[model samples]
Target: MDDKTRVPSEITPDQWTWNVKVDPPFHKKHFNANLVKYHDRVMGQDKLRVFVPLCGKTLDMIYLSERGHGVVGLEFSQIAIEDFFAENDLTYDSEKLDGKPFVRYAARENNITIYQGDLFDLSSEVCGDFDASWDRGSFVAINVSTRAKYGRLMSNLIKPSGKILMELYQYDLAKCTGPPHYAEEKDLVENFTEFQVRMLSEFVVVDSPPYYSGDDFQLGVALLSH
Candidate 1:
């Protein structure tokens, strides 16, 4: 569709389904490097455990695993977890809990494990204490109305000294209202208060994945210290 309707849900049914369907490729095409760069800087050579909230076949997991960091990815959609392994040509074993399956992919002799289930339903024990967090489009997926709840959950679950590297969409109020929801600087700093904000910068980048545009969109990357 057009730029104005690029936001999810507002887009047509086929487009919406396609968006969900091609998550793996979409992440690679659009935002993979940004994640790698951010994580590499924050996580360093510590071999620390990394958490990807609302992970949807994100290439970042592969990047982190390759760099000797352990990965724990949380996803609500089974399709997404399956697609991630399939698309990467990685094989994994599965365990079913309450009729839902959680697929585990271990790398580096079983250091990294990708867990699948409703993000809301996952426990800290399942996710483990993360040294760092990678948030690509996860936050924006929640409606603005529920963002506070999302923030509170993040605060409660995340390790106190851990860091979160997040990407946020900032829209011009007149042009768009979103699922790539608009979030301002104040909101982020306020919402993530328990953690000190280390970095927050805005850049104009292609909105790939859901927004496949050559035109620039405002993207925010913030590093949090708890």
Candidate 2:
């Protein structure tokens, strides 16, 4: 996760990074070109519902919704979710869930609803099943031990025919502090057995704000399908 910066041991990196830092590796000022192109290729112009987990106000939601897709995202941090609406200069209407204290933020201009709550607590009853899901930093951000649980949640959220485009990084663990953890093909297959993991492409980040002593790392983009 871009939020996984090396900081003092006392503070939680994920929440603290969002509170003060805006330059995380995956937080881009503009819509990600890779996402736009990928969506065009597989999803086309259909007004499909797209799920984004651990979504940190990626401008991609605005891009997708403007293209007529319904965008739904889950973010665990209230501050991060609030910052997203504020930073984008987007006016939104928020409503609390039935009995829970959590709120869901909806954009005024597009079909985008972002739920500020835990990923595990989110139900299909709220966001519903998606036609596809975008997992930029989500998989890698989760704890290694919980990959199976994450996989199960996704399997239930995505329709049988739905696809997922996710990002994974491969780095020497000895040299890096991971939350944007290093993952291998076997790990994905072993944990997410319900889906077929097909490696789409790979690229190297030329410049990154390294949290560790390593210079650069490779990012693998994979398509998960049933």
Candidate 3:
């Protein structure tokens, strides 16, 4: 949807928390290929600190951790965090952040930590900073009106020289409304004005899975840096 026609009601943390419990189709049990393909290109460091936004029970966090990168995920759902640990057979210790609206869960043996709370409530003080960030599908999943805010939050969470690896879905706005919104090139540039944006790859698909369907849907992979 375009700026003028975009709806203003952003989905709340409670809504997302509830959605994950129902086994939403968007929840993937495997690592996203796009992430693995672009990992080295987008994230140059082997042992880096990485931030993941709107991270569900994604196996990507484990994938990154296994490769020696420290991963910190910001998610809104306690259910999702619990599932991630249970499915992976990882034991974790939980505690609430002193002044923040989040509970932190850190794996005992891995360099993976997850903060469960509203993304809007996260700050640099609470999350610290990272060398890189990954947005597997979060940019498109959030409301359009909050995109700028989200971008700023990401910018703040990373170091000045940090990089961002993002995956986006693009489609004809007239055909559908989206949780997976149509994030065009211009939208990416505008939202991440502080960074140098590059379109790594893009392709059109006709027969997407039921979770993402469109006649001429586009999938885009991009890398951004300050």
Candidate 4:
């Protein structure tokens, strides 16, 4: 997805870039382990339904399900959702809403649903309110102007006292103009006020297998509790 056309609010669907490709080629086994590590540290509980906003074919959803949490993931692109299931060798049943389709899959015997639709249209009635949110690319994908609205919608989609694990980049503005925006500490604290911010940790691990390659990007993790 190109940075400019991905802005849903500004452009019409036809004008935007819906050309989503398969996610970065990575081993599922390694991806699952990384997700499990994060879940164990941030989620801390089992059997809780997790909401993945703007999930974009991340294998983290599958990892969340394998760990016993039912996963509800939202993606605007159908190609990405299809690619995710196809690469994982998972079978799914699909449903349509006003002509748009969503796919439902079982994640290691746990229910995992991937909705290919507008995030704003997903309601409690459809996916059910989530216990916590596992946000990887969602927050940083939007511009600063839209981050607050994103946070508010996230708070509404999740149950009270919900937890949110957001991934952001800490970089100089000169280097990255970001779809993956570089968020500052103050921006996260103030924007996510509904949730009590506890840890804003910076992790600089050597490019690990499956998730990342050589030192291409520096990342930050924001763990929040609502």
Candidate 5:
């Protein structure tokens, strides 16, 4: 489908709950290399607080915590958050957020917390501003219609000097439908007008998922700063 005629995903929170049960390939058991490589540059310190949007059961959270960073994750599925703690063998305490359809889980011994709810509902009031942010697949995974809102929320969540390390994908949208949508450099710049956007790396990915299997999927990592 052409970009103009493309249908946006109508995926609900329930659908994401089911997706986690089946174990998707995008779910990795280890740290994402891009996140590890850029952590120091983007976050700068070991004691910083990092915000992660649409954070599934990514091991990147654990990786960040191991390095002494306080990690806050926003997710929609309770299953995903539960699985994260279970898989990582961490014990946690849960509490409901007042006046919100969400729960917060805090790991007993780690500086890691995950809030379960629609990411759009997040605000600085809900969670204080962060020092840094990470977007591994979130920009591409969310429906295109919400991309601007996503960017705006991220901007609000971070401090003025905070950096965002984002991983995105680019491909011919006409050839595939996606939870992983095509995100161009222009899209990033347009949504994050307050920040200086820089494409840190780009490469053709050979082993993409079924939706983009035959296409030349260009994976990119961008660093955004104020």
Candidate 6:
């Protein structure tokens, strides 16, 4: 496959059906520190609806739901979603969307619902508007060509008063072709002009994921608000 077409979807056909090496191959078993550390600033409101895009069975959903916040997650992998519930020992009811590739999974024990399908398939009316968005790996996972579409969806889902806490990697992109693609300041400005972007902090990625170049790679934490 050409460089542009190399993406997350291409890994799936072999990953679940056969043995394939994929970056961060297993579903994450722990909470993302960016979410926990910036909790008060990003998701301070109680019972607020939070959107988690490209969520790979992240434990942050449990963290949010337990704190009385509603969590909505979008993921393309059914295997990952099922593994999440099974590994976490959570019971959920499932419903297939009519004429859609998505199957909705609602956790019976918490205020968490996950939509299993392509992230691009989501719409505000379908997933509902969110007061806050926690984008751990979502935005960076987006291919540069499709970032505009992703930004448009965020525009629709994010309320005027909503906030978005995001984590991204900053590095030399040409050398390291990535699913967790490197993002620049101009990229965000061009795609998400409706919101004000602020770089909160930067920390060295310790034990950096295999996808990264591992040469002093840094993780950037940012907050976006309308």
Worst 10 residues of 3 by lDDT: 1-10
RMSD of each: 4.7, 4.2, 2.3, 5.5, 2.0, 4.2
Alpha-carbon local distance difference test for all models: 0.66, 0.77, 0.82, 0.66, 0.83, 0.77
**Which has the higher TM-score value, candidate number 4 or candidate number 6?**
6
* Model 3: per-residue Cα lDDT over 1-226, one tens digit each: 3343644346655676444337666778889888899888777557999999999889999989987999999898788889889889999999998877899999998999999998888888998999998898688888888889988988889899999988877665655567677787788799988988988886556355475445677788888897
**Candidate 2 residues 102-220, lDDT tens each?**
58999886688899877877777777899998888888887776789989998889999898888788765566666777776777898888999988876566454457566557777
Q: Which stretches of candidate 2 lie over 4 Å from their true place?
A: 1-16, 20-25, 203-205
TM-score of 2: 0.87
lDDT pick, better of 1 and 2:
2
Off by over 4 Å in 1: 1-26, 29-31, 98-110, 205-216
Question: Model 6, poorest ten-residue lDDT window?
Answer: 12-21
Off-target runs (Cα >4 Å) in candidate 3 are 1-9, 17-22, 206-213
Q: Considering TM-score, where higher is better, how would the candidates rank from best to worst? A: 5, 3, 2, 6, 1, 4
Q: What is the TM-score of each candidate against the true structure?
A: 0.78, 0.87, 0.91, 0.77, 0.92, 0.86
Q: Output the number of the TM-score-best candidate.
A: 5
Candidate 6 C-alpha lDDT tens digits along 81-170: 887787679999999988777799998987889998887778886877999999987888767678888888898999998988988776
C-alpha RMSD of candidate 6: 4.2
Model 5 pairs in collision: none
lDDT of 4 at 122: 63
Report how far off residue 143 is in candidate 5 (Å).
1.4
Residue 118 of model 1 has an lDDT of 61
Clashes of each: 1, 1, 0, 0, 0, 0
Mark the 10 consecutive residues where model 5 has the least summed lDDT.
12-21
> Candidate 3 at 3: error in angstroms?
12
